[model samples]
Target: MKRIILIGRAECGKTTLTQALRGHKLQYHKTQAVNRHDVVIDTPGEYAENRELARALILYSYEADVIALMLSATEDYSLFSPNIAAGATRPVIGIVTQIDQENARPDRAEAWLRLAGCKMVFHVSAFTGDGIEELLTYLDASSAADENV
Candidate 1:
C-alpha cells in the first residue's frame, strides 16, 4: 500500500479516517504527534494550524508516497493557502471530511482544496462509510502504479 500522509486542522477527522481506512471500528483518539501506521501517517492538527510547525509537514511529506490535505466540510474558511501543495515532490490529494454533517459545505471545501493545488479531491464521511471505497481504490491504484515505475 502507498503510505499516505494526512495534514489538517484539529477535528478534521484525520485519525477517524485513518481508522476507517484500516477497517477498524471508529474511535476518538487525539493525535499528539505523528501517528505512523502501516499505510498512513496521521499528524496533529497543530502541524498544519501553526505556521511554526508547518515546515514539519513538508519535511514529513518526504516519507510519504502521497500527501493528503484534509479539510472539514463544516469549516467556513480554509487554513491552507492557495497553491500550498505546489512545493510537494509527491502527488498531493485533497480529502474533504465530515461531509455527513448537517452544516457540511463540501463544495466550498473542495474549491479551497483545488485552489490549494490538489491534483484530485475526494469527499468522504468516515462515519457513514461514504466515499471511502473510492479513496482506497485510488490509493491502491496509485501504489501499484508507483511499483511499476
Candidate 2:
C-alpha cells in the first residue's frame, strides 16, 4: 500500500478521482483516509483556507511518494503547480482534468504547458475514465523510480 496523496484545486475532481480508484463512489469511504489528506478548502478554487490544506498536503508529500497535482484543462496549468508542490521536490505529476466537456480546451491546455516549458503534463477526464489509468501507472512508476521517499 503506497501513501499517495492526490492534491488539487477545488472541483478539480480530487474526490471523483479517488472514487475511480476505489472502484465506485460507495467504495470510496470504505478505504481508510490514508488515500486522502482530509482537505478543508473553502468553496472556489485556491481559497484562503486552501493554504492550510496546501500545507497539510506539503507535509503529507514528505510521507507521500507521489503527489498528483491536478489542474483544470480549461485554464492555464502553471498557476496551480509549483505552489502545490510545497518544496517536496518529489516526483510530482501534472493532471489536467475536466476535458470531456464541449468547452474543454485540452489542446490549448497542452499548448499552454508547452509554451510554459512544462513537458510533464497529462491530460485526463475523470468523468469518461480517459487517461486515468495512465495517471495511476505514472504514480506507480514514480514510487518505484524514486527511493527518496
Candidate 3:
C-alpha cells in the first residue's frame, strides 16, 4: 500500500480513520504528536491549525506517497485555503469524514476539499467502515504504479 499522511483540523477523525484502515477496534485516542503505523502517518490536528507547526506537515509529507487532507462533513469552515495542496509534491487527495452523522453535509466538505486542490475526494465514515475498502484499493493501485516507475 502507498504510505499516506493524514492532515486536518481537530476532531476530523484522522486517528479513527487510521484505525478503520488497519481493522483495529475503534477507540478514542487523541493524537498529541505524529504517529506512524505501517503505511499511515497520523498527525495531531494542532499541526494543521497552528501556523508555526504547519511546516512540519510538509516535512512529513516527503516520507509519504500521498497527502490526504481530511475534513469533517459537519464542519462549518475549512482551515485550509484555496489550492493549499498545490504546495505538496506528493499526490493530494481529500477524505470527508463523519458522513454517518445525521447532519453531515459531505457535498459541502467535498467542495472545500476540491477548492483546496485535492485531486480526488472520498466520503467515509470510520465508525461504519464505509469507503475504507475503496480508499485502500486506491492506495494499493497507486503503490503498484509507483513501483512501476
**Clashing residue pair totals per candidate (backbone < 3 A):** 0, 0, 0
TM-score, model 2 to reference:
0.65
- For residue 140, model 2's alpha carbon misses the true position, in angstroms, by 3.0
Runs of candidate 1 with Cα error greater than 4 angstroms are 142-149
Candidates in order have lDDT scores of 0.92, 0.55, 0.92
Locate the minimum summed-lDDT window of 10 residues in model 2: 40-49
- Which consecutive 10 residues in model 1 have the weakest lDDT in total? 140-149
Error of 3 at 17 (Å): 0.3
Task: Give the TM-scores of the predictions, in the order they appear.
Answer: 0.94, 0.65, 0.95
Tens digits of per-residue lDDT, candidate 2, 11-96, equal 66666666665456522222223344322111223431266644555555676655555566766444553343344566555567
- The sequence of per-residue lDDT tens digits that candidate 3 reaches over residues 1-149 is 88999999999999999999999999999999999999999999999999999999999999999899999999999998999878778888999999999999999999999999986898999998889988998888844454322
Taking every candidate in turn, the Cα RMSD to the unseen true structure, in Å, is 2.3, 5.6, 2.2
- The lDDT, on a scale of 0 to 1, for candidate 1 is 0.92
| Residue 47 displacement in candidate 2 (angstroms) | 7.3
Write candidate 1's Cα lDDT for 50-75 as tens digits: 99999899888889988999999999
